[model samples]
Target: MNSITHYLHNELPRINAFLEAQTARLDPVVRPAAEHVLGAGGKRLRPLLALVAARALGCTADPYPMACSLELLHSATLLHDDILDAAVMRRGRAATHVEFGRTGTILAGDVLLALANRLVADYDIPRLNAVLSEAILRTVTGEVMEIANVRNTAMSEERYYEIITGKTAYLFQGACECGAILAGCGAATERAAHDYGLNLGIAFQLVDDALDYVSPSEITGKPSGGDLREGKMTLPLILYLRTLPPDARQKLETRIAQDDLDAEAARAIADRVAASGCAEATRDAARGYATLAAQALEAFPASPERDLMADMLDLVLSRNK
Candidate 1:
């Protein structure tokens, strides 16, 4: 295996352990449900980013608590998001709400969110908790925006970016910022970390949106054309719109605005978006952000940790699932 993959293998188990161990202090009733979501498989991307950020900045203190906070925050979002989206599967398993019931899953997610904040609070760095809290607030706001804009015909590219930056990028930005803060890095370096994470997070979401149109169910652990059926206008569909003639664009917009689109109709439109090369266009946009993310790392001097973090950009851009 390549170095990045090898490194990921080395770190994944350690972070997974940290994620599980954090739940031990929770009330027993909520503990099992919390553990269930935590145990459900994931790449643990947010936590790993924090750990790597701390290492890159030459941190001496243990970073696991801070690192794990990102995962807890992210997991909590997943639990709540699955419910909001009415999703049936996550990480190739039944969604937490499906197995645990919606109320239990929601409570479990809320507990985990609190636990995440508590972990940061224990650090005694008021800024760390502030950073995490802002991320949570922004993330939730993004979700609300996304929900509000469903089937919205006038959704502009600028507006989409605004929503996604909150929906995905802020948490990523917060993760790196917390990592840098924990390392006691200078303000300039901390800014660099923030830029890198913000751009990378945008790229990550763009790719996910692109994949929604093309990836098979097994690959994404979700239904094909799920976004289209749900009336969510993603980057691929948005880009595809710009290429159509006036009448066709109007028709497509009307279709997107439909209160209910069946599977066949959703699949058909998704296929057209894929075949028109808009998915690739979305990926190309992702590459631009990925490049920016790489440049952000240049603010720091060379080190194995820095190089590993840079490699993560390539990994994010290359994700097909």
Candidate 2:
């Protein structure tokens, strides 16, 4: 196996064990649902990023507790986001809100958020606290803005970038920055790590949006064209809107505005998008961001850790689900 793959092979089980152990300490009211959600597997990518970042920066101290906070925070967001999206499946299983009532799911998310905070606080690092706080604020703001802008055909690319950066990039920045801080790295190194993570996050989300049009429920663990039905215009769809003739584009916008979407309508549009090369265009955009993500590591010296980050950029751009 390559460096990154080999590393994950060894560390994934240990990381999962750590997370499963923490589930027992959650608030009693939300514990069962929270455990169920947590048990459903994910790549745990955010925490994995933090851990690799710490090692890349030559961290001597144990960074697992601090790094794992990102996973907890990310899971909490999944619980809350599923409610807002009315999503049925997450990580190939029922969403927390489906298994537990909405209130219970929301409370479980809150408990996870509190637990994440406590994990960071135990390290006694002011920068870590501030990073986590800012990530939370920005992520919530982005989600609120997304809700406000649903089915907006006229939404500008700049505005879309801003929302996605807030929602996705900030949390990634926090994770990498926390890793750097825990490693006792200097300011310049921390900034490099921050920039790498921001670009990586943008690339990750771009690919995810592209796959929504093309990937099926079996492969992706979520319904294909879920965003189309929800009337969310991601980068792929937005890029497609720019190519259509005026009348055709207007008709599509009108259809997207329909109060009740049927399966046929959603499927037709998704198929059109897939055939139109919009998904490939979106992947191209992700490649640009991935290039920036890799470039951010140019200043760091060569090491197995550094090499793995380069491999990670490729992995992020290539991910289908």
Candidate 3:
């Protein structure tokens, strides 16, 4: 594995240990489902970020509890998200809701969320609870907004930004902020880390949306056109729809709303979006956010940890999976 991957691998074990320790105390009925979903390996990006941010701020103590807390919160959100999206697959396996049934998955998610709160309860850090509580609320609001706009056929770019920022970026911001809080960093440094994560999260989601249109099934671990089938509005489609002739746009809208798009139609739409420069535009926008993320690290002292954080921003920009 590369350096970042190696670092993540080392850190994740500690995070997982804490998670297991916490989950072990949960009700027996829900514990199995929670473990099943948690054991399904993920990138563990949020927890990793917590560790990275803490290290960048010169923290040398164990970050495991904070990391575990962030992961549990993230896992909880994913469980709920899978149900909301009716997502059938997660991490190359059946989604928790599909595997355990919706009610079971919901309870498991709730259990994980409660575990996260328990992990943070003893932290004794200023603003920690306030930040976490707000992050949770914002994440739910973002999901609700996205659901409300699904299949609307007229969702605006502004609305899309609002949804993604709230749903995805807030948690990332919280993770980084939690790291800074644990490190006892100054408010400015804490805010900078939060900004870095927020921008990185937005960029990450944009790349995910782009890949949903272009990546193969094996690479994405999900079927191509799944987003289209769900009537979800993404950046590429929204930008392309704006540039199409009125009649073509209308037809495309009807097809998308009805989820009637075939592979050929999906490809045609992707090609048109690429040809119209919207894909490039979307990529440029992601790059801009990545740039901001990198800039957010300027206040930190020069160190390997800081450089790795910057490199992570680049990785986010270029990642295909």
Candidate 4:
């Protein structure tokens, strides 16, 4: 089994080139903002997922164009998310909103989304178009629900899963499903690919939430405790609250409810959650999902690509950013 790093090194360049060329076509005013984010380095995981799934299903032709569409879609979502989160940083640089103003940045994001639709439509595949559309709707619905439930300290673990699945997992599911569709895989194989992506995405989000509490801003490319500062109850904070005594839990909840949880308070809570071992527990939960993601890969026959898919669990579980 080749490591994801290996596949990434071999596969990401084509996706990157495709993204660069496509982004270059934006309106003159929109081009710079779009380029800024497109040029900013990311793991390119979604596109890589698409490429890997296609290869695992025995496709020989280049999948870069199709895979890059997923990257564009993911980038569009991030642009909107930064505005909603009031995020100042992304990919270790100022967020698009910070650089281009909210309106311009939002317009740039819309352009990327429109390009994604255009690219997908270029294939003239109805199933592919339908999958991407459903995924976009799910992502928007998840974001809206997340905002509506801000500071919901009593939000259940089940409900939290629903939010993350819609926002994060569904796109991953779409990426893998897209790969399968592109490769002309059988129905069962496509379902397996989707299952793999869904579980991997859930684990990825859990780890990301844990990273928000424990990783330095330099490492994560965003401030630690941003979720807490924004009043979003992620898995670590949720698990930590469960272990708290009544008085402590109430105090913590009150602090999170503030419109502005200052840096000092946010750092303190982040530290407390880290110290309470909830961070570790959150990682453990992620590991469980990673296992499920790996299990879903068992339906595929043995091959380097399938092995790479199986190995993705380790990559997702251990990633720092």
**Per-candidate TM vs. native?**
0.97, 0.97, 0.94, 0.97
- Compared with the true structure, all predictions reach lDDT values of 0.89, 0.86, 0.83, 0.87
- Tens digits of per-residue lDDT for model 1 on 163-264? 899999999999999999999998999999999999999999999999999898898888899998887878898888888999999988887787557888
Error of 4 at 231 (Å): 0.8
> 122, model 4: CA deviation in Å?
1.4
Task: Tell me model 2's lDDT, rounded to 2 decimals.
Answer: 0.86
Tens-digit lDDT string for candidate 3 (175-208): 8888888888888999898898899989988888
Q: Can you write out model 2's per-residue Cα lDDT over 22-136, one digit (the tens) per residue?
A: 8887667889987877889887788888998898888998888877889888889889999999998998899989989899999999998999999999989899899889988
Rate residue 112 of model 3 by lDDT.
86
Minimal lDDT window, size 10, model 4: 1-10
Better of 2 and 3 by lDDT: 2
User: In model 1, where do residues sit more than 4 Å from their true spots?
Assistant: none
Off by over 4 Å in 4: none
Q: By lDDT, is 1 or 3 better?
A: 1
Candidate 1 lDDT score relative to the true structure: 0.89
Worst 10 residues of 3 by lDDT: 266-275
| Residue-pair clashes, model 2 | 0
